[model samples]
Target: MPRLMILFTILLTVGAYLLSKALYLRYRHPLLNIVLLGAALVIATLLALNIPYQAYLPGRRIMTSLLGPATVGLAVPLYRQRSLVRRHAPAIVAGVGLGSLASMLVAGLIALMAGLPREVVLSVLPKSVTIPFAVEIARIHGGSPGLASAFVVATGTLGSVFGATLLTWAGIRHPVARGLALGTGAHGQGTAMAFMEGEREGSMAGLAMTLAGITTATLAPLMVRLLLRS
Candidate 1:
């Protein structure tokens, strides 16, 4: 990639995020989502500039790599919430396991109902998990990583944008329950929102996210094999 193209990618990505953050702060609306807005701005800029995605891949990869450390950072708050986690270990395990299994099964069933191709079904199977784990799950099941990543983003974004409102409507106000639900459904974005709720919420959300990822990674391939067998 040209040096100029790399610079463009970095500037565009960071600039779009900053702009979206400012707007979100002003509006305080779920629709003012930074990810959705930043993605649109970045894509529009690249398209208008006639820059291909390949030119932005390096910068995008750098951004993607940051997720690893961000995920690790969740341990700090989780350490603070250790007693809470210990008290609720059984509930947490059941909640995460059920959430992970239900998500994969539902995705697979939807793909089947829609008569999508086998690879497409496999790709969608991991959509509820975080991107890195989802991509690997898709690859392990002979699916497309690009599709897996896209679906993961869509799932997380939708969940993050409206999940709290839905929880409120249902009268689910317990922080641990809310955190687990959000984390299981939305992954990183949900965890971020949970942190905004409070440290205990964030800790539970982080734990739920990790548990869901591991469960999805282990079960997605098995589910695909079962689908094939059926």
Candidate 2:
């Protein structure tokens, strides 16, 4: 019965994504973001079915395992732009470093100021990165891993939906700048959107996303310790 339940969960998740993709293609609207729509559909279905999240954990874990391979796949785009990427290596590092650090600091400070617990600050601190890593950071900080994952998904979805428009409004017409902004702020979903803009944008975004995640993972704990006075 548990295996059957897991199968059902997987099917529901995939079906929701497919439907959401179709809707996105037909409407071509940002709000039709498949991530947001698919998540909502999955959550709603779980609710309607009275299925506990834990009941779907097996299928979810199976899905989560793919994140590593998917992340590795990002290297393909980067490799394609090696010469161009090397030319701007320093700038790329600077942009990603600043953007990623700024996001963590602002979010962490705000969470602290709001009188939220130290653990809560930790969780939000890693929200700018991918979820699997975010969960680990949240655990180290005594945060709710679930909330950390939720925040990651929300950040990615929001970034993907608004990143391009926001960059254009900010007068950042350069593909590199836009890609850095999206990947640093949004992670994988943002990278996917960057790919839509151009191969160069996608490549840069992939690099930014990889760098930001590693930077966040390495620096977050030290910053947390210092911020919390421990």
Candidate 3:
């Protein structure tokens, strides 16, 4: 039974991925992001069938574990852009740090004002960061890691869907500015969109996303501690 369940899960995941990819290519809308589409389908199917998240988690984990290797693979782009990065080191660091801090501060303040529980606020405070680091921050701050994952996904989706349009509306035309904004605000999803623009933009966006994740991960716990104390 376990083997059959595993096989079924694998088949469903692959089918979903293929179908989502085709849809994305045809429609090419940010709001219908492939990741979001695939996740919605999986979650809806599981819910309809009354499958507990734990029951399906092992199969999902097998697929998710590959993300680490995939992230490490982004180092190739960084290496390729070493010279440009060196030239813009200070600007990159400052931009990413400021953007990450601003995102967390806004989320925390809104959550607090909305009377969300401290743990829920903490979970959302790091939502703009990358998934793995955000999960760690959530655990440290007494937030639910699963909820943090969902929050991160939500943040990324919103950022990817609206970020470019917002920037254009604000008259921001520089590739560096666009990449930095998307990478810092949306993390990987935004970076993916930035990459689609061009290699230079993609490299900068990747760098920004990594730095933003690190900054947010480092700051979230401290901010939560201070907020709780006060």
Candidate 4:
């Protein structure tokens, strides 16, 4: 694409995020979540201008390339909280493993109950995982990667918006538990929210996100088989 289009797309994406983040900071509301708000603004702007999504591809790829470094940065907080993690290792393992499995089973079962197609059920099975893993798992199971991406985003957005309140209502006061729940259910968005809560929570959330991804990847095929048999 043209240099001008690339620049415009980059500015639009980053500008929307900064603006939404500012609004979120000022209002302190879950509904004003930066990711959700920023995405809405971008989509609305593109649609209003009649800009094809293809025009945004270059900038999207550039931004996506940065995700690796961004994820690696989580290690800083994880390192700082190493002692606590070691102390709580058993709980962390069990919580993340169970949480990941539960998310897949619940999503798949609900889709099956709704009489959704087999492909739709498979796509939903990895909704709680981060997009890369979710897409691959969906592809492996002959599901639509595009649909899987949508499910992952929806799951993460909703989880980031309401997860903390629900945890509090359930009397889950421990930071580790909260972080694990958020990470396993929401992935990246949840990790962002966990960081906003505190460093300790953020570190555990980072760990949980990684562990949950691994656990989901390993167990998803079996889960699909079980759901199919049901």
* Per-residue lDDT over 1-230 for candidate 4, one digit per residue giving the tens place of the 0 to 100 score: 47888898889999998999899789876667666678889999999999999888888888888666765575675677778779999999899999998899888888999999988988999999887778778999878977898888788888888888899999998998998888888998898889899987787888888778778989987997888965
Q: What is candidate 1's lDDT per residue for 35-89, written digit by digit as tens?
A: 6788889989889989888888988887778776776675675676778779989
By TM-score: ranked, best first: 3, 2, 1, 4
Which candidate should be chosen as best, given lDDT against the real structure?
Answer: 4
**In model 3, which runs have C-alpha deviations exceeding 4 angstroms?**
none
Best by TM-score: 3
Q: What is the lDDT of residue 176 in candidate 2?
A: 85
RMSD in Å for all candidates: 2.9, 2.6, 2.3, 3.3
| lDDT agreement with native, every candidate | 0.84, 0.84, 0.82, 0.85
Model 2 score (lDDT): 0.84
Worst 10 residues of 3 by lDDT: 221-230
- Clash pairs (backbone) in predicted model 2: none
**Ten-residue stretch with the least lDDT total in model 4:** 69-78
Model 1 steric clash pairs: none
State the local distance difference test value for candidate 3: 0.82
